[model samples]
Target: MSIAKRLASQTAIYGVSSIVGRVLNTLLVPLYTSRFVAAEYGIVTGLFAYVSFLNVLFTYGMETTYFRFANRPGTDRPELYNRVMTLLLLTSALFTAGLALLARPLMSLLALPPGHERYAVWIAFILGLDAVAAIPFARLRLENKARRFAVIRFANILMNVGLNLFFIVFCPDILSGKYLAGLRPLVEQLYDPSIGVGYVFLSNLAASAFTLVLLAPELLAVRFRLNLEPLRPLLRYAYPIMLMGLAGMVNETLDRILLPRWLPEGFYPGRSNLAAVGIYGACYKISILMNLVIQAFRYAAEPFFFAQSNEKNSPHTFALVLKWFTLCCAMLFVGVSINVELVARVFLQRPEYLEGLSVVPVLLLAQLFLGVYWNLSVWFKLTDKAYYGAYIGVAGAVLTIVLNFLLIPIIGYMGSALATLACYFMMAAICWWLGDRHFPVPYPVARLLIWLLVAVGVVAVSWWAPIGEGWGRYGFHALLTLGFVGLVAAVEGRRLKAL
Candidate 1:
């Protein structure tokens, strides 16, 4: 099979776990938006942003390090695995304990409600569970255990969504005598309305712990040992990776972290900073269609890139990945942006959340640019020039931080969205410029940019010439989307089929 086809098939399997499972979990947006006030949901959004940053710290890029060394000549795979797992176990414990011990202070720092320190403790455990699971999950990808990975990951999402429903949706309803009133007495023992939005944290904690339990077979299979001889080289490689990861996350999540801090009071008239965050977070979900694609592609690409590193055609293969990835994202951007209103109304639940829909297309395109950067970054990863990746990431993060600080005060969340778009675009451009100098790839950049420009033009037309509402408006949008698709096929069909 062609390299692209093999990777595409693997992506399809992983997509079931990522794309399908995340879509299921994302479907809970309506439930959360309905049950909690915007400010309450903002707490969820903000804390989870920190969770992203903390997760990168806790794992510290060790999973990729494990992949790098485990496949080396003359290496003992089990011993290497044991060392990585032992280190992860020890550090994860310390990190979780530290957070639990300082939950109250951390809660205060986060600006969470007094007495909501339990949220910090819950997040700590969730972070630890996720950190500990990193190596085993990466090993599954390396070993081509995609189906097992998919099943376990899918089950985790199911458990999370189910618990969310039981707590947030069903329990509240029963207690309110909305339905199943007879079960109110039973639920009172299990549910506490006073906890309120705290159930979201508890549900996630349970799901994360449940996932660890499910991975017990993988964990148990590792021979117990604490060998540290392999530790030096691994850390040497991983430090840059950790730096890159942390910076990449800054580009992705710093907006969430800073929006509330920098957004001026009374900026949105009736809206508080937290309310604006809640609205932005909810609107961000509209971009998940693109995020889902990037995620599945990453899960598949990382391993594939490593395995194909020795092939003579590796650079060309990487270029194809970028071209196709950009094409898919461009098509997605136009299709979704033109029909964003219908999409927003379906998932957002509340009219208040709909106000931030303007950011959706920008965020979607930003994610696309980030994915392009991911593809361009293969040169650094393959050449063992990982520090260069860190440099690029730090550059992007600095731009992200600067842009958010400058923009949020002036234009609200829209500034945050624009910052994200500009940050990723700059990162991609820098990576490509460096890649061309250090390790050139024959990416069809001109054709790729043309596709994106065409997509934006079509979306603009939809905005300028609305065909009213109802089936007519939607039909017009659908036709526009299909026309974009046909244009892509006409231009790229022969090359695509060759792949």
Candidate 2:
């Protein structure tokens, strides 16, 4: 099979896990918005923002590092996997222990409500288990076990979703009446209505633990030996990536983290900062379609890029991939932005959450730039200049922090959204300029710009056009989407046929 076809196939398999699973997971948004108030849901959002940050630390870039070393000609794949696993196991255990010990203090720092420190404990376990699972998951990717990988991933999401439904939906029935009176004790023990959003974290913890159990075969496949020789080189390559991952997460999540504390207090006299955060978080889910695609592409692209690193036409291939990726992202941006209101109405249970709908377009565009940056980053990874990746990430994080602090007080959560857009655009542009100096992929910049302009123009027209709120509006948006798709197909058809 052709390399492009192989990459597309792998992406489809990984998409089964990422895109499908995340879309299912998105179903929980309504449940969350319905069950909890903005402030309550904000707690879930804020804590998970921390989860994203700590996950980077826990895994410490070892997943990519494992791929880097494993693909080298002389490397012993199993031994390398064992070595990485051993290191991850030790670090995960140590980090979880330390976090558990400091749970109260950390929760206090995060300004959690009193008696809610247990969130820190549950999140600690979730992050640790996920961290340890990182190596095994990467091994599956490296070994080309995409089907097995998708199954395990799907199972974890299924388990999490099932438990969430049981606790949130059914347990309340048992508690409210005598329908399941015999199981009241068990239900009461397991479910605390006052704890509200805590069940989300608890469900995640259960799922992560279950995933570890499912991965037992891979866990036990390697002997328990901590070989320092291989680990030294691995760490050398990985440490920079760890730094980059940490900073990249800051760019990705720090806005949510900072929003609660930074919003002006007097704006909503009775409402807490989390109220604003909750609305923003709920609306942010509107961009999940874009993020889901980026994730699936990254999952497949990372390994594929590494495998193609030594090929003669690798640069040309990378350039082609970027052009097509940009085209797809542009189409997605138009589709989501034009139909933002429909998505908001369909997915969100509370009308109050719709206040932040205006931010969706900006966030979708931000994620598009983020996807482009990920594509451009292949240069640094391929050329062993991974430190350059760190440089770009840190620059973006600093930009994120500075912008959030400056903007949140003025424009509210919109400032945070704008900051994200600015950060990713700058990162993508910088990576492209720097990447040209080192790796020189012939990215189709003019064509990509034109595609982006067409997408933005079409969405703008749809947004401003005086259309009624019936089938006419829906049909208009549908036509716009189809027109964009048809144009892309017509333009790229000749190129694809040449391939």
Candidate 3:
């Protein structure tokens, strides 16, 4: 098989974990948006953004370090694993304890809804559990244990989704004596209506704990030995990576973090700032369709990039990867944007979420730029110029913060969406420029930009299409989406086949 084809197969396998599992989780979006109003659901959205930040803090690049050192010739893999887990265990324990102790204070500072203070403590455990599981999950990846990884991931997602349905959907019905009358008394004993949005956090915590239990075998085998010799070098190698990951997370999620605090009270008329946040966050899920694809591609592409770094045709192969990857995303970018009204209706349960629906296309385009940036990132990763990634990510995070603060109050979430688009667009541009000088890949820039332009034009055309929201709109969109696919196939059939 050609190198590119091999990478494609690997991506498909890895995607079973990411795509399918996340789709299942994504299906619950309707339940949350439908059951809870924007203000209530915003709590789930806002708190998770903080959890994402602290998650990076807890893991701190050890996962990547484990894969690096464990893969070395004649390295003591088991010993290395134990040491990494020991560091994680210690740090996570301290952090979780600290967060639990400061839960009430954090609740106050975050301006969490009254009586929802326990969310701080719940988030701490979720972070702690996920953090310790990081190295083991990394170990699975390094060992090429893809199926094992997929199974564990699916198990966690299923458990989480199931609990969410039970808590958010079925429990309420049971309480109202509408369904499963026999279970009303039992659910009454366990479920609390006041726990309303808290179930989201509780469900997530249960899943995290369940995930850790599934990974317990990885833990059980560890010796808990802390050899200081390797620990110093590991931390040295890891801290920079930690910085990059933390910065990148800020770019990805800081908007959700900022939207509630930054939005003005009169922003959405009757809606509070938190309500505006809820709307932005819910609409953001539609854009995640693009992110899910990027994530699956990344899991397969990262190792492939490193492995092919020394090949004679590596640059050309890398270029082809970016070409096809960009083409796929451009098609998706157009498809999702054109049919988004239908998508919003299907995926979102509240019309309130539709207010910020304009953000979906912008975010989709941002994720497209992000995918290109991911492809270009190979330059730094392969050339051992990791500092460039750190620099670009930190710069992007700074831009995101500045743009968000300047834009949210003026344009609401559109400002946040545009900030994300601008941040990633800049990151991709800078990465491509630096990459040409350092690890030059002959990426078909002109062609890729044309695809993006065409995609934008098509999306714009769909927006202006006089066909109202009827079967006529659906049919018109289907033609445009399918027409784009056919165009790509007809134009690039031979080239795509050659790749």
CA lDDT of every candidate: 0.89, 0.90, 0.87
Ranked by lDDT, top first: 2, 1, 3
Q: Per-residue lDDT of 1-499 in model 2, one digit per residue for the tens?
A: 9999999999999999899998889888988888788888998888888888999999988999999989999999988888888899999999999988888887776677689889999999999999999999999999899999899999999999998889887899789884878999899898879877788999999999999998999998977878788588889999899999999999988988899788888655556788888889898888878999999999899999999999999989999999888988998899889988888877678877888888999999999999999999999998888999999999999999999999999999999999999999999999999999988989988879888889989988988899998999999999998998899999888987886
What is every candidate's alpha-carbon RMSD to the true fold? 1.3, 1.7, 1.6
Q: Give per-residue CA lDDT, model 3, range 234-336, as digits (tens).
A: 8877887788888888998999888878888787889988888889889899999999999889877776776677679889888988999999999999899
The list of candidate 3 runs beyond 4 A from truth reads none
For residues 237-333, what per-residue lDDT tens digits would candidate 1 score against the true structure? 8999999999999998889889988999999989988999999998988898899989988999899998888889888888888888899889999
Candidate 3, after superposition: displacement of residue 250 in Å?
Answer: 1.7
Looking at model 3, report the run of 10 residues with the lowest lDDT sum: 64-73
TM-scores for candidates 1 onward, in order: 0.98, 0.96, 0.96
Better of 1 and 3 by TM-score: 1
Report the poorest 10 consecutive residues by lDDT, candidate 1: 221-230
